[model samples]
Target: MRATLIYGLGDVRVEDVPDPVIESPTDAVIRVVLSCICGGDLHSYHSWTDSNPKRMGHEVIGVVEDTGADVRRLKKGDLVLAPFTYQDGTCSFCRAGHTTSCLHGGYWSRFDGGQGEAVRIPLADTSLFRLPVGGDSELLPSLLTLADVYGTGFHAAVKGGVTEGSRVTVIGDGAVGLLAVLSAQQLGAEQIILMGRHCARTDLGRTFGATDVVAERGAEGVTRVRELTDGLGTEIVLEAVGHMPAYEQAIGVARSDGTIARVGVPQYEQAPVGNASLFGRNITLTGGVAHVAGYVERLMPAILDGTVNPGLVFDRTIGLDEMAAGYRAMDARESLKVLLRP
Candidate 1:
């Protein structure tokens, strides 16, 4: 089997690796049909300085090839969506709809990377969502997004309290941020402001639901948002960039008593969250890694019916052997998202 491995920063390779086999009674093996590169993967792709190699990729959709003795929810030939993270459905956190924080859960990379020909999934019954049989091929890309990006964007919107007629500002124009705009609109936000300078991405943001695009940065960006909001910042600010600057911008542009939902993977070791920055303004700072498994089922219908097309984020598709170039294209901002066909 050929799998993607990150040997160091900016060094992704496709190499032959041993095929994964069912290792536990609750595990299942599946042939990966489609997978994708995620923005979070870039963090490791850019900064990983470890000497040891690591498996890459998490967003995956595949067909079950074999099931463990204890697995009953899925079987051979069943198409499944494997959320970026795996969780035991019986855990308290999972029952409470926070599957990302499940007591016995971990990322797909822990067992088998998604950017591979096939993978071994542990806790198959609880970790994988079997897609409806006979779904169209056109829906595959959208269904693939449900495994991560779309669900993540939906999580950001929900956590930020986006509702009918709400004013929303999304800081970051990456795939997740772009989808956040779409999610905000679907949730009924009347005014969506996207803060990003990239022409292509902001254009997609507008199509997604952004009523305004602010191409400014730092304080100027905050000022632009304030101007659009009539001096008070937006009601909900989504920080999707996952950096200190993006976080600060989100904090700066959020109105007093507003909420900032940060779904970006934080790259900083520490963030300032003192009274001067948060408590004094009565601002609610929330958001973390999305509970993708929890949101997938709810969002699947929307994708199936074509109400949302978050899959548009995949600007390019490449064979598994071209994954390194795929990473380069994404890192260079030449592409929004890259889908890999194994």
Candidate 2:
């Protein structure tokens, strides 16, 4: 089987690798039908300096190839979507809505990443969600988002307490950020302001539900958002850019006593969180790795019903052989997101 492996910055390779097999009773092996590059994957793609190559990819929709004796829920031909992480559904964290933090859970890219032809899924019964739609369904793209980006955006909005008539400002216009705008819209937000510099992406953001678009950056951008809100800023700021400047912008556009929910994988460790930043203004900071598996059941019906189409984020598609080119497209911001067919 061929899989994607990153040697370091800008170096993506597709090479033949050994096939995966079930090693645990809770495990199942699936032949990947669909997969994609994630914004989070770019973090390692940009900074990986290790001598060893790292496996890449997480979001996957595949057909079950085989299952261990204990994996009773899935069969050899069942279609399923594996969230970025695998979790034992019986754990304390799983029950608390923190499926990403499950006691026996771990991310998919650690080994046998979904970019490969086949993957060994641990804790299969609870981690892999069986899809109602067929593999050839046009809904495949939208169903795939339930594995990461879409659910992540929903996480940001939910954490920020978006509700009917709420005023919200979403920072960044990446896939997750744009989806954040959609989530806010679905939650009944009366105002959705999207902060992005790219006209193409911000336009899609508007289609997704952004009532306004702020193309400026830094202080100028902050001023634009404030001016839009009668100088009060938004009550909810969804920070989707995980950069220090983006954090600053979230602080800049958040009304006093508001919330900042960040879903972008942070690129840096330290940022302003003192009195001058979030503390003095009574801003509550929230959001982390999305519990995508937990959100799949809740968000699936919408996709199946054609109520929303988050798959618009995948602007390009490539075969496993074009893995490097796909990465280049995404890193250069030439593609909103890249879908992979293995």
lDDT (Cα, 0-100) at 324 in candidate 2: 93
| Per-candidate count of clashing residue pairs (backbone under 3 Å) | 0, 0
Candidate 2 per-residue lDDT, tens place, 189-280, comes to 99999999989999999999999999999999999999999999999999998988999899999999999999988888998999998899
For residues 4-29, write the lDDT of model 1, one tens digit per residue: 99999899998999998888899988
Best by TM-score: 2
Per-candidate alpha-carbon RMSD to the true structure? 1.1, 0.8
lDDT of 2: 0.93
Query: lDDT of model 2 at residue 246?
Result: 93
What are the lDDT scores of the predictions, listed in order? 0.91, 0.93
CA-RMSD of model 2:
0.8
Candidate 1 has an lDDT of 0.91
Off by over 4 Å in 2: none
